[model samples]
Target: MILFDQIIFGPIHSRRLGLSLGVNLLPIDAKICSFNCIYCECGFNTTMHDSPIPTRDQVRETLDAKLHEMVAEGQIPDVITFAGNGEPTLHAEFEGIIDDTIALRNKYCPTAKVSVLSNSTRIHKPHIFAALNKVDNNILKFDSAIDRTMKLMDQPVGKHINVAWFIEHLKKFDGRLIIQTMFLRGEVQGEKLDNTTDEEVEAWIQALEQIRPQQVMMYSLDREAPTQNLQKVSVDELNIIAEKVRAKGFDVSVAG
Candidate 1:
């Protein structure tokens, strides 16, 4: 329901990335993503538009202009984030755009970090992997470690995706990636779903050990989700989960 109308929309405060400037590569009026997540703030993928994605030149021009303006106003952001309508890596010129963004950030706001929020669906693509490696924060999502729970939660576009395959693919990043997970419980359609259970958490912890990310970001919903059945997990529960992950010798942060 929150559709961004411009390529550069905010220098808004982010829970993780402070004073962030959002870059939307997808269509302005609709959601464009590979996953039809039940808790997506932009609603379901079925409601997305058929509009063509923005051109590399268009993104370059818009982002450059915005950075110049922010610099002149002495309002440089802490981070330039690639997140908006949907999965940003889906852009045809994603690699070129990342190059452009990095160049502009260096010129106008040299101290600012370049970050990308990816669904981790396209990491197998050589170009996408290379582009992600160039950014400051290569944040990837993995909500559940169990195949059945992942299928129920993420609802990925490709039915061939499985937890085992996904985990193996994630290990390709080694320790360079930042893993982000959203903790919640609810029922969609008719089946009961919960990822905070000991079984789910233990499985997720084991997977994280294999991937061995630099850090893990754990949080619960803070906005109205597309699915009304979802319930936000408490902060105390999140801390407990974070501790479990921390006990494994990996750094973890909890957000509610």
Candidate 2:
């Protein structure tokens, strides 16, 4: 039920990425996402709204000004993040925007990293993959490795998508990407769901082994979920899962 109302909204402290400055390429007044996740902080996708996606030029200009301003205030962000009301990759000019953001970050605060939070739905697209590779931290969502659990959790808008499809494209990263997983328990549409079960965790670990990411980020709901029945996984539980991932000889970061 929360929405960011600006193109350049936050330099807020992020649990995973510190001092994060956000860029919202989607409409400021409404959400535009490929997945209508029950636990999305922005709530369900908005079907109707007049707000337009910002032009490439507009994003460049605004981001440039904001970065310049932050530099002047001696508040250099740790990362320039492409995340907000909805899926940032959905923007037609996403690649060009990443190009612009990189230039601005270099000019204003060269040390700051550039990151994007994506749902991993568009990684197969040539342009999106290229753009993602250019960023410092290409964090992607992989909430569950099981087909049924994933469908119930992510609620992807694309009917053709399945766990098989995700594993296939994700391996394309070739260990260059960061896999982000959210662990939680709840019931949605009258079915019990929990991605933390032994079987679920085991399946997810197997998937991660194949994906071979450079690192893994694990966390639970830090904010209220739209689905009222959802429960947050305890920090201890998260650390346990993180340890399992660590045993696989992969770098893991926990943000609970």
Candidate 3:
């Protein structure tokens, strides 16, 4: 329901990241994420689009202007987040864009952290990996560690992207990244699905232990999902799970 019409928008308060400024690398009129998650706020992906993805120079200039305006207004963002209608890593100039963003961030809002909310699909690429490592908070999505649950929930565009694929690549971060998981329950095509189940949670914990991320971010549905029968996992349930993971010495943050 929400497609960011501008290249650089927001400075809105985020549940996970504070006073955040958003950056949309995909087309302004269409969604181009690698994963067609049922809970994506902008709905499913659109193949056709009227506008093009912003270029590196355009992003840098517009972001510079925005940061200048925010500075003049005395309203600095807590984080400059790369998130919007779709995946930011898919952009051809993503590495260059991150470079420009870091420069602009240092020039305008030195204290503002640069964060990217990726689906953990493109991190296998050397350039993408380098770019993510450069960011202050490289938040990646790993909704379910079970292959079946992940395929059903995330519906990754690449058929090869299974739980194992994620684990193998996520481990490459080597405790430098943060893992973000969405906890929820529902039925898809008459099949019952719930990541909170003991089996699912245990497998997820195992994957986290292997990755050894610096922190883990857990949250449930905050917006209407495109599909039906989806149920939101409550804050109490999230905390219950967080406690188990925390026992394993993983710093977990819950945004309910």
Candidate 4:
């Protein structure tokens, strides 16, 4: 089922939203993201390419045409999410897309939310922060609070990135920030790693409290990953950690 996925792919059932329509802003031939996490489903980044950037007008045109068709067919969705092969924020006209997408949704289906599943690499950009503030939900990634484990798990693009600095930046965002974490056990580069341990989970909770995100979405692998050694954490383990976050008065959801 993997090919060049069109601009919209599901009203596929989602745990949080009943049905979600995806928006793919990156070029279809290769995955585009700042971090090459071992568990990413689109596979790893072989080389960086910058071509075929979708213009704001094109995004509006494609999305409008799809929404019009969906409206006529009465196929309403719970959300219109910015998620796809890679990071949606990488799109040059991200702010424009957010503005246009919200306007189109209001015209066609006002009940549907404009949401984004971003990695939070570009949250430092004032424009990106302002754009994300307009969305109904801004789900950002924060896999591990420890620097050494973060490098092992996320494999970020540059050496300058620090977890502490990222956490600080996220705290200042003037919108609802939903933190997303992927819990798993794996061996990468011949080294064994586990992120579901008590100490690791405690550190993550501390970061959540410091950032004070509006919500948290915790889940494990659901598709084939680039790293085969990674094992999905069980529901029981997820619930134990989730309860700890919930006790701190933060809403948490365990997605399958």
- Highest lDDT: which candidate? 3
For model 1, what is the C-alpha lDDT against the true structure? 0.90
Error of 1 at 203 (Å): 0.1
Evaluate residue 127 in candidate 1 and report its C-alpha lDDT on the 0 to 100 scale: 96
- Writing each residue's lDDT as its tens digit, candidate 4 over 1-256 gives 1323566666677777668888888776678788888988888874665456567887799999988998999999889999887889988889989999999999999999989999888888899999999999898999999887888888888666889978988998743788999999989888878888888988999988889998899999888888878899998989998999999999999976
* Candidate 3 local distance difference test against the native: 0.94
Q: Model 3 RMSD to the real structure? A: 0.7
Ranking of all candidate structures by their TM-score, best first: 3, 2, 1, 4
Kindly state the number of residue pairs that clash in model 3.
0
| Cα displacement (Å) at residue 176, model 3 | 0.7
User: Candidate 3's residue-wise lDDT over 125-199, tens digit each?
Assistant: 999999999999999999998988998899999977999999999999988999999998999978999999999
Lowest-lDDT window of 10 residues in candidate 1?
A: 44-53
Clashes of each: 0, 0, 0, 0
RMSD of each: 1.1, 0.7, 0.7, 1.7
**lDDT measured at residue 226 in model 3 versus the true structure, 0 to 100:** 89
Question: Roughly what TM-score does model 2 have, to 2 decimal places?
Answer: 0.99
